[model samples]
Target: MSEWVDVHFQALETCGKRARSAANMLTVEDVFQDSSAKKPADAAQASMFGDLSHSGALAGKVNDVWSALKEELGTGRSRLQGVEKAIDQVETNLRKATKAATV
Candidate 1:
C-alpha cells in the first residue's frame, strides 16, 4: 500500500487547462485600459461639471481593481500550471520507483 501512489492526473490537467483558459479570456487592456475613460470624462467635465474629481477618483479605483484582478488571473494560471507540473513529476518518479522495485 505504501508503494502505491494515488494521483488524480485528469483533475490536475483539467484545472491547469481551465486556469489558462480563464487567463486568456481577458487582455490586460480589456481589464483596465487607461485613456479609455479619460477622453469621455474630460469632455464631460469641460462641457458640464466643473468638478469631476469624485467621478475621476471612483473611476481610478475601479481601474485599480480591474488591474489587480488581471494580474491575479495571470498569477493564478502560472501557479496552477506549476502545481500540475509538480504533481506530474511526483507521479512519474513514483512510477519509476515502483518499476525498479519490481525489477
Candidate 2:
C-alpha cells in the first residue's frame, strides 16, 4: 500500500503569478515618487527651522524612507522570482518521479 500526495500545480502557479505582479506594481516609480504631501512637509519644517542650519528636514526624511521602501520592494521582487523558479523545479522533479514510479 502506498500513500498518495496531492499537489495543485495550477493553484501554485496562480499564487506565484499574483505575488510577482504585486511586487512589480510596488516597484513602479509612480507609487510614492513626488507624493503631494512632501511639499507641505517641507514647508512645515522650514517654518519651524527658520534658517537655523537645521539638518532634520521632514521632507528629506520622508524621501529617505520612501527610497528605502522602494529598495526593499525590489529586493522582495527578486526573492519572489527565485521562489517561483524553485517551485517550478520542484514541480518538474515531482512529475518526473511520478512518471518513473508509474512505469
Most lDDT-accurate candidate: 2
Clashes of each: 0, 0
The TM-score values for the models, in the order shown, are: 0.52, 0.58
* Model 1 lDDT at residue 56: 61
Tell me how far the alpha carbon of residue 36 in candidate 1 is from the true structure, in angstroms, after superposition.
21
For 5-90, candidate 2 gives per-residue lDDT tens digits of 34465666677677667667666464657675432323234445555565357646656876677688788878877777777777
Q: How many backbone clashes does candidate 2 have?
A: 0
> Model 1, range 1-97, lDDT digits (tens) per residue?
2422334445545665675566454555444555455222222222243456577666666667766776886787677666666766765676687
Whole-model Cα lDDT of every candidate shown, in order: 0.57, 0.64
Model 2 bad stretches (over 4 Å): 1-7, 30-60
Model 1 CA deviation exceeding 4 Å by range? 1-52
* Model 2 steric clash pairs: none
